[model samples]
Target: MKIVDLGDFTVDTQARRLYRQSEELAAEPKVIEVLCYFIQHADRFVSLQELHQQVWQGRVVTDTAVRRTISKLRTLLGDNDTEQPKYIRSQMKRGYQLVCPALPGEEPAVQSHAAVETNAAKKNKLIQSHWLKQLVAGSVVSALVLVVAFVLLASPVHLHTDYLQVELDIPGQKASLALSPDGHYQAFVGRVNSGDKWQLYLHNRQKGQLAKVSTPVPHVRFVDFVANGAAMAYVGFRQNVAELYIQPVADLAAKPQQYVLPGLSILAGPLALPNNQMLIAGGESYNGNIHYYQLDISTGQYSQFSF
Candidate 1:
């Protein structure tokens, strides 16, 4: 399935569903299906014949039917093609087009069985699996990203220098470490060499000296502290490509909980905010550039970071 996020609304082109935050916008099933077709072929202007072939599978339908379905999709997304056309664009004689910009490795929010009463209060969970599949299906191509970007958010709160300190391990080959808001613990990467082979080491603050911890993946290009310092978000590199992995910091001797976020070719840090939640940057290297996203620990929900 393919997923696209346009700030407030998330469109899953594969499933033909529109979600506002975490709640699914109620609409006719046919309308949702039509919207999906436009999103799948976002850049191309989908003609009536193409739309019918993809969405309806050669089903008979009038021009009025297509227009009405497109209209409903716009309304559900709080958009009007005539005014604020964020999602879809219409033509006089041609079919519709997707105007919203899609990010590489970006996922759309999927509404679960649960519903939220207010759109403002609901937090959308960006589903990555569906979006990744769609991109690969569209084009069998990939690219290489040379630079790794790091961004930190500013807040009114200040950390006591004594409680937390950051440094690069010797050569600083991997990403830097970050402390939680409370400052009870810290997380950083340790380096180890096995004769021509180099790897990142996972280290945490224990009783006294730093101890070695086994991560979800051994060799990684990036690592970040998450879950208020209870977990570490690390990325593994193979063939110059990276994928994200989440592991716990509780017991270094014990195995950590691992979560595989597919389609993520590169991941950037445990960027902690005032609320204590962490942000990680990730993307599909071959498809496009990277984008910043926030991850919720309690729910494991991810959303794109707005300026």
Candidate 2:
């Protein structure tokens, strides 16, 4: 079995496994394929189109799926940090490249499927063993907590009946809702159904009509109006990476320009500021811990708030 040494971890190409020291990290099949492709083309930028052709085997797949796979690989490889992705580096508006050097090692004598299966079984057993120990150790405390929770839930509770409710006919769950500075249009991200992807939509209060914004990607996380409601700025996700985009509101058919923000994974609450700048909240971490940032809409430059 051929092994590729990836600094902190090793990739067993024959077995299709990634290992950090003695621990085997579980990664999806597609993620593994993507990682291997990056390693094979480590010298240059691998464009999204190339990835779609090679990784997905020329099959039609949404850009979101590729991005999601990359995200999963980043998490598994401990390259989740936006400021410095140790393994894979994303080139804005281009493709991704493997920053880490992978060296080939001597092939193992045993390359049979049974051997690979045995190794995978051993790794799973190790994981289950560790989980069993933790479960046993926490059983007593968990039992006590469950008892308390049950008692609290069983107690008679008074419910408030006096409450005012007003419902508006809006499609999907509204997220990152923002009103235009001129109060003419309301922009928000919405997913029509459970299986549908979130998309950006504009609600015109004057006309009482909803219009869909032409997003390049399937997922639109945040949106806000710029240029005095003549233009719109939004954070869009493609292949699990967040990018800033600006488009003319008058002509939604016009293609939007994508902006590269190196370390931001999730962006939210985009507020337009003076002088073609924006105030936004986003983060590099997966836990949704975010910080305020000021972005120059024209230049795509950003600086994080300190305090």
Candidate 3:
């Protein structure tokens, strides 16, 4: 479809553009998908899970991603999730609705340029006043931020600081933890507290499920999830040799694909990157050099850079 009318704005679907009269507005493809989907279900509620499954096409994305798309669409429509929402009606955990889905052949009545300018001038004055208030608020916020940072660093955790910490009862957990790209699962290294070597455990926060994900090689130290969130990469040391391992989060029963990382006595990271690549930070310290490497999971090859 070329043009979609939605009250005050016109959306050009094929062009991936949004316009308010003659002024064209930037809209990303994903944002447009969200907007058009709302129009298709105009005045009806669409759940977040529905948007994730239908709009996102069952792709692996976090709830945060869906909310961000809604925010972007609302911005384009001159609306907000709270305070000054004009076009989209959002109900907490219920869904979203298009408030004014304009019927075909209906357009906003043209206003005289003089009248428009008069309104703009009034808005400009109000905006100037709003900005002055914001300037004062910004300074207060900066001071509060500094105080919060000092308290977090110098003192222990407290509700008076406005941050909550929840400790999950997983298997014997240690320090290193990795949250999946989708923010649904967390992987931590722990043991059974029965004189067992440390390995990896995956926890699904949404489902409240936990599982052990250990490779054939023991003593896993560092772990990270792949970009797609269905798989993970980790580093383990066995017999004074450090090896890199990649395995699927859905299934750890099968042996993980492992690669021998030569020359590095100590390994720290397997940072996820795009196109099945990750960053490995470790080098032969005894050789008087520590380095970071780009490891290709598909080919099991590592490339180092200078400086």
Candidate 4:
């Protein structure tokens, strides 16, 4: 397939990086393979088997892997499911294709392609989905047990003893703060003027008062505190559009790394679980009923709350 330019983004086949304007968009290695395959085979709908073989090779892969990767790629490209996607488009039973325009950009070298068919891939996808549903159901049961244990065995008096209050102030803005799971840190959001000007700050409650946790940037909205207190989540914006970002506290001075939060904006109420994974409440707005999403720290994948 011929690579097309979309003005803002270019699929770099030779480099395996998706470029927006002049900057590279962060995408997983596997996601790049899947996207590059579609970009190379634009227009024609490529079946799941073909995509899996091309992207995953002879290795076994679950349908959740494909769906999750596509979902992540779409989010990375800021594509929405409601409209005809400007990046990837799904043809239901037929397969998936790249429909968005690719702009002028450098190409990556030697991207492996898959050669699987539609029907076989679809069946695998169904099986993967069925098993995933069962696993999620089991997780829900486990989660309920934990919640109940905390409620019954752990007395309210003991829970109240762990309570800590942290306050933060950002010069020239109204600040909002969220406490970490261990309650040792707080993530703050500051609004300078209105509409879009925002800043993210970290306050170390364990250090006595609220300490500045981050360097000042143009627009950063606090997303959550790392479950382990080693990092934080925030939303970074460019040209008015925003994307989710994760930054380790030790590397606060360096440019923050970006993570994909497909189709959603404004991740908040960051809670890091004991399992060392992160959780962020996501939606368009807080009052809009955000869905809680678990971040797989290892794969950077998102799993939605089942119950």
Each model's RMSD to truth, in Å? 17.5, 16.5, 20.8, 15.1
RMSD of 2: 16.5
lDDT score, candidate 2, position 152: 63
Q: Rate the local accuracy (lDDT) of all candidates.
A: 0.58, 0.75, 0.73, 0.64
Instruction: Give the worst 10-residue stretch by lDDT in candidate 3.
Output: 102-111
Instruction: Please provide, for model 2 over 1-307, each residue's C-alpha lDDT reduced to its tens digit, 9 standing for 90 to 100.
Output: 2699897788887678777764565556888889888888899999888999998989999887788778768766757566787889897888899998899864434446676688768745754674586598589789988876776678636423344343248656878877777888888888879787888888787788788887887788888887677778888777887777888877778999876554577776677666787777778766867877766777565655422
Scanning candidate 4 in windows of ten residues, the lowest lDDT window is 108-117
Task: Estimate the TM-score of every prediction.
Answer: 0.44, 0.44, 0.45, 0.41
Off by over 4 Å in 3: 1-167, 171-173, 192-196, 285-287
The parts of candidate 4 lying over 4 Å away from their true place are 1-171, 180-184, 191-196, 204-217, 237-240, 283-290
Best by lDDT: 2
Give me candidate 4's TM-score against the actual structure.
0.41
Candidate 3 is scored at a TM of 0.45
Candidate 1 local Cα displacement, residue 1, angstroms: 22
